[model samples]
Target chain A: MPYHFYNTISQLRQNEELVLYDRVLHFSEEDEQLVKDFLKIEYETESLNYPFTPPSCNAAAALWGAKTVYTACQLILYRENKEAELPLLLPVYNNEMDAAAILSADLCLRFLPQALQQTKNIDPDDALIAVLENHLQQWHYSGIGYVLNAATVNFDTVFANECMQQLYIDRVIQKKDMQRAMLPLLQKKITAAMGIYSATFWKELNSDKTHE
Target chain B: MAEDTSNHLVYWMQLDLVHKDYLAQIRHWDNLKIAADEQSIWVKDFTTSQLESIVLKSIPFTHLYYCKDNLLFPKSSLLPVGKQPAFLWTPIERALPVTLQGFNHNFFGIQQQQALRLAPIEEEQKVTVLLATVQDAGNYILNAPSIRLQQLKWIFINNKDALIIGEPVLPVNGRSYWQKGRFIFPVGYAFEFTVLEKIAAQQIDSTGTHLIWWIDEASYCLLHPDVLQPLSIASWRQTISNSPHKI
Candidate 1:
């Protein structure tokens, strides 16, 4: 599995560079002229389509990069620990949102609110841990499983399958209590993302106006 | 005296075992054990709810059955019985794809009472596949062009019933589409090929054949002949993106 991951990443890196080269080489005279004009701008500007280093980036980032990070982290951790085998990095089993939610609610009640006043909604100390627990280190293995099974086999499919599998297992264990606690937070994030996407979309559509 | 104490301890154990939250109730037995040893007595307060709850949770796949709404869960289909419509009361965790082979094979629906009937037999037949984003086509309804559009719209038709001499175009969630319900097709959908060839040899008929697909989930249909779904194109496009492909 590690070898497969390594090969896939290398192939993806090569493919990304090749695609950008191809696009730049194959552009028509008009597109070439547009590129030249854009280059005249002193500030760095990204191509609307294939701008970033590897060129294109999207949801697949969650699938590929996230999974890669997850697998690599496990391997490195095992090596450092000098363990005979890698630990099944099933984070959700222990540190799911339900556990966090209960802990956070309890903490909020236990600790004085004034102590957290200098920080954002949640205390800075608590926030750092939450970000690590919920976002980065949480359930990477499980998310990958869900993506692989459910989504079309692509860059992100593995992550999607793994994620879903973890969610399913977690759902079984925690039942409705988990969903009830997490839904509001998930909904808020989703809504915020939608807003950003639509705004960017509309801005791109009227990009000609910016030039005018 | 020892025999009497053992019998009394058994009675408390029995009461704890019968409770809804039997595990929590059973924990009380530790206290009972202490009390019995110290006082030369046995006692317990076991609630029926605790034991019953424990029993309910103990059953494997109990929640899965609850999720499936007591539907017969088949691991694999041996007999290719004509497409049976059964609602998945709860959505599956995994994503299902829309592909030529899938159109020939898979069926999906919500867990509800819908009709399954025989398809019309025709010596030569075409299977129509409709591919669209969730935004474009809300839900696709297929019927021969000969059928009145207005009446077809008004009347309810089972998927199999409409697909006479035809296979249903399995709705796969396209990549761009949000993963939500059974109807959301995330992958760009594909219909079956005109010529069915042996899987290994991969031979195709020389003569041209086509299946009409209603694109963008509209009433309109485009006829495709001998062409594999253009998934490679979308993939090549994504290749330009920095992200590595997982699928």
Candidate 2:
């Protein structure tokens, strides 16, 4: 699985060099110039859909690079924003080149605080807590999907409780309006996630514990 | 002298004659002298003169019959046959896979009704035999049509301080019959020639294909090739054959 980071700034910085190479190698002179022009012009929530073949398109490279740099500057400017509202409200950035990396990092960072708290509260008798701690540390360093997959596959009571708690916290924090329609949908997702985690976990548990 | 309660003296004499004849026929087969060791001492008590008088004057009992393995005994010798057999044959010490084919149905009720189709036995493999007889039960008398021996059973025997593993249930059938009662045998155990059911003569379906490994008496596991594969004699055939004479 591809590594993802919780920190958007770190991801943007890492992708900067690759984005630069893509522009130089793949972009035609005309498209490159067009990308440069597009970067200079900005609008407030305007439909800024840049037409370019992602990764190979000069315009796409320029737009992604520009967005990364722009976002980094915005993070700095909004660093003092007590609620971090501007960063949270930023447009959902999905481009093929770094989509997985960005999303995974975001999820890791989003859950890291609760995961750490939950780990602290974990029972000493639980063997799986240590594993979760190690995975959490790896998530911080590797900024990847491995932690999620590992937790999912080797789910124990402690890890599952932590995941559920994290989900509840996320739901409460994200959905302040509390629409009645979305409640059941969110509950269903939570149920489905736990069901899958339990199934995989039990299967591994039974096979591993076999006497023969 | 202990009185023959059933007045089976003539019957016993007749059986003794059959025993002598059977012994003569298989004398060469007893290379290890096991039959000599196991023969009943009662055979010696009856004299030729006594036998001649009984043969001339006495009528044989209806249930009396000579069974395989040189055994001559009354069929109704034991009453209330539901209990486990009292007489158990000592497990053959140096058992070979080839010899087991002949002695597969060593147990009385286990009739080899059908030909056993098994994988070719490798020379190295050895098969062991363990037999038990109900003390009073006569030959061919059974309490139930079928008896369940084990359930979800895994057997391990230490041989030469090394563990010999045996899965009684065939693995494929075992998947579905995991919790369901299934008959399993030890490793290198013969699958065919062992009767899972002993129905009455009228109930027997002679024309139907009889599978040694069973689903039921009429419906057998042979119909499902997967179920028969593991229990197949070839699966247990090994390269090293144990000599019966060694023991």
lDDT of 1 by residue, A183-203 (tens): 332324323322333233223
User: How close to the true structure is residue B232 of candidate 2, measured as C-alpha lDDT?
Assistant: 15
lDDT of 2 by residue, A1-212 (tens): 11121123234333432112121112345554543444333211111111111111233433444443433333333334433344342333344423222222332133333433443564444333343444333332121222332322221221233322333323332232123112443434333332333233224322433542
DockQ of each: 0.01, 0.02
Candidate 1 fraction of reference contacts recovered = 0.00
Model 1 lDDT tens row, B53-172: 564346333211111222322323233223322322211111111234445334565465522112222343232323334222222212111111111111001211111111223333
Candidate 2 yields a Cα-based lDDT of: 0.29
Classified by CAPRI criteria, candidate 1 counts as incorrect
Against the true structure, what is model 2's DockQ? 0.02
CAPRI-style class, candidate 2: incorrect
